[model samples]
Target: MTANTLVNSKLVCVALNDKAQLAALEGTFNEAPYKKPPTQPVLYYKPRNTWSVDGAEVEWAKDFDGNDVAEMVVGASLGVVIGKETCRVSAADALDYVGGYTVVADYSLPEQSYYRPDIKGKCLDTSAPVGPEIVAADKVATPDSLSVAIKVNGEQKSAFDLANMERSIAELISTISRIMTLQPGEIIAVGFAGDRVAVAKGDKVEASIEGVGTLTNTLGGA
Candidate 1:
């Protein structure tokens, strides 16, 4: 596993009670129009079987019906690790609860407009490539103002100003805490920017933020 994928990215240990099914969690962020602090934090989970580390590759699978699988989505998100137990936190005190930050590339096969209900499309092995390193939160002055971008096959494809995020970093932390207790070392990935594209085998994916360095991985067949 690469250091960039997990360090500071909140890793939540889950249990699947039934033998036939696995537990999963989906990563989320606020989209525009709903900008300014989110009224509430958003969350979703994938079956536990779908996680993978850096350097691993995911194979494209055909659905039950015979149709060429057209697209997939890879989400590169900024993860925030909570430093202390926080519940019902105030926005002003949110930054103090952060332990650090990391980068995670969340992958989904065969692009679908909605993220949930399409869990099978997203939870494939080796789809999530994460790690490089975790930069301490103290090192970043304004987490909400950082610049994030992505490149595929050395071509720039997606870019977003962190300032444009629907919700500020601190606000998200505070808002989410109210729903569930955020523990030390727990992770929270900032949502993706508007740009989403398709990728294929042999392509290289790179995600970067201004203060946080880049994490790169290549797509390949199983």
Candidate 2:
């Protein structure tokens, strides 16, 4: 809701089932680790610098190949906002800690591996654009399954449903809490199971999740 409210909170991203992408990388790199999909939630952090509100501009400039203004992989996802301190919670009771849900665009530079933290790729300024509003958890008809879509420059580029996620919202919360404590106001980006394509400067990107909300951001040169 406010930057002050989220000062100490963390933004965690989860990968539900990225087998196809992983396998593709394995072939390109001829590596063993990418041969199979991860069994658990593959988590990464989007630090405070990445935080932005809906309608904000997401700037990108670092090009890994050193050509052109860098494009980003835009991930449309559901964001679950934590309402209370959570630790070792059970899947059955995980919803109790949720404050609400919002739409988040998880942006990052194109990456080949998830083996190590890609701080430069993901933790960039305005990489995580969240919210125009927070729909109280109880308002969402079915948190587990919702239609999600992404558009760049007014052209629809990707579409999918949250129902395709490998884990339920509660299960994800239960699983993540066992590893680290989640504080109030923190957000868990429940993962994007759809296509994530690169977008360039001046592209107006919009990511929306059914029943939750929609977030719009303009990609600009850094």
Per-model TM-score versus the true fold: 0.75, 0.87
- Stretches > 4 Å off in candidate 1: 1-39, 46-50, 58-68
Deviation in angstroms for 47 in model 1?
5.8
Off by over 4 Å in 2: 1-8, 16-31, 34-36, 63-69
Residues 26-66 of candidate 2 have per-residue lDDT tens digits of 45435565556566788888888888888877777566685
Candidate no. 1 TM-score: 0.75
Worst 10 residues of 1 by lDDT: 16-25
Give the C-alpha miss distance for residue 85 in model 2, angstroms: 1.4
Q: What is the model-wide C-alpha lDDT for candidate 2?
A: 0.78
* lDDT (Cα, 0-100) at 21 in candidate 2: 47
Candidate 2 vs. true structure, TM-score: 0.87
Candidate 2 clashing pairs? none
The model with the greatest TM-score is 2
